[model samples]
Target: MSTFQTPQYTIVELLNKAQCGELQLPDFQRPYRWDDERIRSLLVTILRGHPMGVIMTLKTGGHNVRFKPRPITGIGHEGLKEPELLLLDGQQRTTSMVQALTGDGVVDTEDARHHKLRRRYFVDVVKALGDVREQEDAVVSLPDSGIVTGNIGRDVVLDVTTEEKQHAAGLMPATVLFDSARCFAWMMGYQQGAPERMAVTQQFLSTVAQSVQTYKVPAIELDKDISKDAVATVFEKVNTGGLRLDVFELLTATFAGDGAYFKETGEDFRLAEDWARTEEVLHKHPVLKEMRSTDFLMAVSVLITLSKRRTALAAGKTGKQVPQTSARREDILSMSLDDYRTWAPQLRDALPRVARHLRDLHIHESRGIPYSSQVVSLMIVTTLLGERAEEHAVRARLNQWFWCGVLGELYGSTITTQLAKDAEQLPDWSLAKSSTTPEAIIRASFAESRLGSLRSRQSAAYKGVYALIMAQQTPVKDWMLDQKLDFQSYDELQVDIHHVFPKKWCEDNAIEYWRRESIINKTPLAKKTNIRLRGDSPAVYIDRLDAKGLSAEQVDAQIATHAIDPAFLRAGDFDGYFQDRRRRLVDLIESAMGKSVVRDWNVDSESTDAPANFNEPAASTGGVSIGGEPTPDRTL
Candidate 1:
């Protein structure tokens, strides 16, 4: 049965009473979460006579929650207490009306998170201040810094002439909903969200904010007598965020729904908050951002695992709850959250050849996991494989399937497993068949918007980098994979990408010419040497080939295969570097495609040049490298 409560009240009346501090929130709640335009808009909607929704609350008869209405306009949020009333939904709309009509307190809406993402339920002080009296030197002038905690991140003191209604409350859009003292209001006249493309008129909007103009469910009263888990079940089905509520959230709601202290701000919220901070870091990184949210989630999983805090989120009230701190926060919020960033340093110190081994998955796409999930799965797998392992490279791709399969088996994981299953359906011998390909991901990523717009989190340009990597690596794995020279395992392999002119060096000299992800900067080398010698120019790198027991000629020949410019290498820059490499890799890919045939080169075989008949380049030039012109495929 539905626990939804159906009730209605004037937003203006709620706001008027709330401003006088007649409303308060349950002790189990957190502070006001909604931001500026959101709260102001509620007032406008109510003034416009727009139909708002009803509010729902749980009935707790002295279990432990005691809340006195504060002079706060919107609902207040404090820690949870036992046997208290809990708001199940309609929080924003109701609180908004309370803030607007009440003179007791004002809601703060400064949208300061990350970068001014105006959270709903926040107040607009500039507008609210107009109703106050100007006792300060004729008129109160706000200082440069007047925003308080929980307010959007605006840097202005909101001192206003306490005489005008406009100054009394910030001008807000028409869609905000506020939870007020014993009342709430929003555009509830229509049912569900109207699809009129914000059809609310500008005139009405000037008065009532442009909020969702619909009258959906009013409210539902929750019986305290019922089990909290049952109440949680009702909430899980009722609250929004259409995507499934994360595992912990569901568990928390169900497990503690009836406790007066369980309504809000529990272990799950803390975990999500921590995850969000980490998500902030990953979104900024080139590698992590290239992966999907699932992949990012995996990274978080890996971090949590490595941190030995795996159970922190789901841990119920254990004294060792997840530590919330700014320093830990930096792990996710301030830096690049890439494999290179975390494992890079570790890999550099422990296994210099990490990049070569890492890219093996790209050569042959593995199925059964989404790329993001795989990344997480891979991190865990890699952790399981141990660090400083030079020979574990080949298993990199293999472990992806193994460990991920186990995760699926245990958690009933769907997304990652579905991705794996989906990859098998792709064309044969394609790069995506081995590991997830950038192209496959991109096409799938924006099956909706090819031009750009990866998501609200990452940018269009960033997605391009991932797409580019996939294009170069995955499409021609049969031919490309062979470049490693025929060994089942990455360690047994004779050749790997050797930066002929180390990228770090090239970057210094030819800053403008060096391609960010150039194919030329890469060449085949032995597993051992690539790690020992990093960022060396072609000449220096060739000289150091002995560390891997390779002769100078072989090293030079290996570098030649990539055909990067020696002059560019010498100058360390190639304005034409990327374009040239793009042409070469594309040409190579095309030649591989045309060949109805593919053969692995034996690195150890002391074979002479191919017979004249076999030396001819293969059949079709399948892909067009993004160079100035399309060149014919030339297979080595």
Candidate 2:
């Protein structure tokens, strides 16, 4: 069967349908955004009998496709009514025409600069009939007051605030264009007021005004039996608005169309409001603050699909008959409100537990998280594990899989397919339900050579190394204060990643840039301590720390906590410190990833030699600062 039909609708017919609550917009449609200039151009097109464009709509009352319907922007009706059609495209054009050609003719639009405006459109009777090229100039947009003023509102340049003034000036109100009775009465008043130009008024009425009154607009209407996904795909392709509609928006519309939900709640279920409340709850935990609405929906999808797969197995379905567990877009779009209700609260509780797990790994803030995308799989796996997630053995296995994803840099690209795999396998492996290792762990491999390129937080492994060092079994400590860097001090003292050997010292001593700025040379430090060590050598700073209060032994102990070789640091031996710290960082990564990093000690020799001056322009290398002072070739 044909899924759609191309039909023609007149401007008056569409406007009348809008006025009587027959034609409406789907809830997912963006609001009218046509500015004053565009509205004027549309009016000019109608007056000149030019085809504006085609509009696309969906027939309502389809069993398969249901979206909450809303009235056109300027339309007002006494009570809600079931709309026969829902506009999917050409919203801006339809809204502009309805406001300018019907009702009060005062369009609630914006200026070219996007400033709000309330305007009424009119056509000069004589000019509209003069030259086709001058049709645009004939269209006038005035303020809602129907007055144009000059000289700081002291002089009235033009006034059409009353019907008498409109008739005397021979200006035809666009509001009367679509209504025959109103158009006839206005013409009669204009002829009575200007008997000398009676012939001109009649000619204007017959030619110019008549063109606008009988404008035909092309419309393509989708059949009522089209699927929701088909409607979404067609709407995105035809919608002139630039923003692409997402699955959340489609589901929000579908959920609102649930007549049962409205009957019970006495109002439409607002998914946006529910998401805002979810954010309020999740924000209480810093590690979970980065969770997006789509991420939550994906987690719910994983849970629902997993249940479906298990149900299929229980029903003795085999092979292709069983549903594959999925968090894909198609699966998420098919989710019912009942599915969300079943799993949303469980996933919400599981997310905070995920945050605690991340805190245990010393990822104290959302910014420190290596891959925020991995959090979804973790939430689902943790929820499936239930109380067993707290057990040491289960957590150990979960931590291994997480670090494999991070240090392996697997979650940096498209991850939906891998996420589904982990959602299905990780919990089963953790519970000993299956002996097969999760694909994330099996695919995980880290090379020793990646350390040279791991200069910025932009790399997931760099962040993973930082977190591992801070989260070492023996707590790390700040250089000056000798305070233990736990969760409390991590936040209270305002810690951040900073260079160890100091960029100034490296440049002064002619160390290679790659080795100098590498993640192996950085560690988390208190903000005040970083300020104190600005552009100074480690040897210089260690003595200053000693002079402040701490003995040499205490300073060395604090330095050792960060996996640094204190003797190499105290001797100002860059080569020895870099090599020793590299091995130590690799060990920490291996312990977390549950795999050995391939050693390529000569990888640094394969790179270009450092420039003789070891100094480059700040822009060539990402510009950096120490205590907010710019230095050449410095990187954070």
Candidate 3:
């Protein structure tokens, strides 16, 4: 292998050669995610002639690399052939420069299906140039050309091809990312267009070109000693205190580190001021978004695939060599993206079967695992069965796999071996499990367990677990779609989870915790009624309505079946009618599970579940609990 030397490369010359396709990005590169503020800041720095870093690239074998365009629109080059040039170290600055100085912006991408690819847009270079100048220069007419430049808002034309000077404003003839080669100085600073600054910028460019003669770029060479894991560590170290680029950022550079960038990988190259829209394609995909459920885990998983073939954590990180990491990279790129397009049919078919299996199963806690085991299972199931998880038959496979993990015993969940066991047994199990609903599978998983974890639905323990479990994917709509939970097709009427005992009222009565927030106490009601009843005491609310129209008895009757018509709107007398409702809920909970919880309190008795969180009678006044503080009671 040749040792890396500081080769002389002028900024303009490098960019021009790159325009013919020299610099490239690897497949792991993500689209731009910076918002406008950051983009403007970078452009200002460059336009002011601050030296941006060198455009670094690793030398590689003569094999041509593919170069995908940063998701941008307009007159930029859309594709470049191999040996592709990967953007290393200076992506942010480069992208900002291209987007702001050039009028080229990523408008919309079109897939082969001709579906208008929804892309995030970026500020054209004209806007960026406008941002750096004094405010007065923003609207100033330029020198007989549409080009707007600013030292202090003066305008200059870099290129003018249109017939009319005024009509040219629409063109804003400047170099964007696509046509950047003509106007860029990648390793140098930008030449500002304000009349005085233009002279200075031109001087700066010339000086930069001369400096390349001995420009010692303090650089590390990409070599066999640098494995993917090694590269990841290096990245983590560099970003200890600063804002860290995510794992994908590191992994992309590693793959393209040998200076091979792929043009079709769809990296976000600052097409929009809103950086989140950078990778509109990846973020919009149901599968990619769904897989992104848990950021840390998903981050590692994506990089693992990209770094080298799908490594199963078994490959010890001690390889300490380049070829091995490169082989792994090949495996990552080897995984067929074609699998993504076919995901809907495959995964969608599996979710319902998995949902049915989990719909009624009683999971237990209090023994093998502490309290809050149910949520762990819930998160895992949701992930494996959530909208995107259904891709590639993830649900049916996960359904079968989960059953296998639990079939060993009731408290059979082992984070370590669960995925493996399921993976091992699933091929045959999926056949029988998908076609046949395994009632035994649920019992097989939780029989010896207490099932107490299932009872504390509204506890903080449950909420924390839930928050940790979800992947926290963005564009929440994509996730909902993956879960098949889109409620749009349903009627105007909707079901809302409402507090049956009127939490605020319970607080006043000192039994707030159990009665107010217990998942057991939550019920479905019409959306409007839920809002109207927000915190009204259910008993008093019903009693007040009696004067208007509804008899307390009639309200009680209606509530008994979990149905309510808001005929007594705003009357606020819903509580006198709750004793029967509480009883119904208890009965319903037991009925739903074919078992009973040891709830001894009566709905009519003033004695309540206030003591559930250990609050005694002394603390029960003024809506306070034991210790003269509010306690979370489990009964009402």
Candidate 4:
């Protein structure tokens, strides 16, 4: 039962079908990923009358299921009924054509991912075909601000302040060539005064029109009876678009092939729709809002893996051993379209509950979560355990898991295996009321060497330290306002990573880059405070604050809350201050984790000696006592 029609379509006919709602994209196809370079290269090929590529479509209006037809380029229309064809492949080509011919952008209201294509595109006819024709010269997509005429030249320009004088220049809206009348009106608008130029321009445009009219795209039409799985296979075999289809995308196409749509609501099996809905759900919770669709999918995979294993164990199935980590990842990769469809609903319901559980453990927001792997295991554990998730024993083991995962950098690489191991242990561990403390699990890796070289923010250990800093509510507020540092209000507050010892000050004092740029030196403060603190040393800034009526009590509170040693506020003593503060910060981190996990107290300074001029003695060494010690005031 071969059910396919091979056809060749000119650009004109292809666009007309799109305009009449006869051509539609399947729900699972990813949104347009082509950048301006790819789009322009496509236009160059089309202008030269070259075969763009094959478009794959599925026929509709038979006994087979079908997706609701949609206009190719514009916003959605309620007027569209059923489409005669559902695009299985070639969405990128169709979308580019629609934008080039109709001047409408391919809107993306369904995918949560950011899109690069949004504005209408125009072609520079002169540049597209000059003495030296290059792909870059063919077409220019406009920015959000639209076209600017004055800046036009070799390539696309942004502003159009110089209007009619440049009209002698050949700039044509990509859509104008589609219709004779619109094309004529456009030519007349620019060709009014210069009749000779108009004739020349008209001839050039005419050639373009002919090129567009005659350009052929090969297409294969699948019969309505084609199975969704077969459609996925075909796309995998023949897809020419730059990004190869991942399994998620393949399953999406498979489901769309099934044409599972709600008859009353007109909703279809668009995986993007489900992904977008999951994003919406995550957005309602402060901690999960920043998660991507891939993250959500991974959480679902963990849930599926664990639930299956637990069920098998309970049923006394002796032969089915748990898959290895790489094999577990493969299991997720090979998940069937039907399985994805079945599990998506459960994922949507379970994810929020998981996020709530994370919040109880002081992972206040997305920034506080160290890795995506941690989110997967936790999401599954919380989902499977439900009300028992908050039980004393479950909480203790989960806490151990959290700190151990963070400190050990458990999810840094080959995360699937680690997640599988955690998932396998969680059901039993939660029920047993006992598990190894996070400190004990990662005890071998804990050392003074690890603490001395506090790595970049990307390191899990650094993020672990940061999580503790955040959990302790370090009294560094936004530079501009009185609001305490909070990740939940991040949108409204322009908080920035600030240096406790300003970088410029270190540079001015000839400090080495490593010591100046250490993670231990950075803290989160509002943007305004960072600017205000600019090049001042701690002593100068603290003095300025004191004069601004920063009470003695307030200064003491800031030092203790932020784990800053009194020596840090003094001038010079850079090595000693770093050492003192590093120990203090490590202690604070250990306190938050409820374990004596910090094994290092030495500062890993590249050079131990400070500049001779920088080591000035303090004017007054006595001040307010903080955390039971008298503060030292050094010379600025």
Among these predictions, the greatest TM-score belongs to: 2
- What is the full ranking by TM-score, best candidate first? 2, 4, 3, 1
Model 2 residue 247 CA deviation (Å) reads: 1.5
Per-residue lDDT, model 3, residue 282, is 28
1-636 in candidate 4: lDDT tens per residue?
Answer: 678999988778888777777787765566666556566667777766667778899897644334444466553566665678888788887887776576443222221244544555566756655544553575665653454445345555455323353254566667766666766666677667767766656665678666676778899999988754456567667775555555456545544545334553464467777788887888888677766555556656766666666676777766647433322434555554466767677767777777766665545666656665567667766766767777777776676667666765555445555556666666567668445433324431444345445545545566676656655645444423446665464445665456778888898888766567665677666566667676888777766555545674565465555566645565546667777767767666555445565464333442433233223222223321111111222000
Q: Estimate the TM-score of every prediction.
A: 0.35, 0.92, 0.44, 0.59
lDDT of each: 0.35, 0.81, 0.35, 0.61
lDDT of 4 at 68: 42
Model 2 regions lying over 4 Å from their true place = 79-81, 130-133, 193-199, 263-267, 607-636
What's the CA RMSD for each of the models? 17.9, 5.4, 14.6, 12.6
Model 1: residue 343 alpha-carbon error in angstroms: 20
Candidate number that wins on lDDT, 1 or 4: 4
Residue 541 Cα positional deviation in candidate 3, in Å, after optimal superposition: 4.1
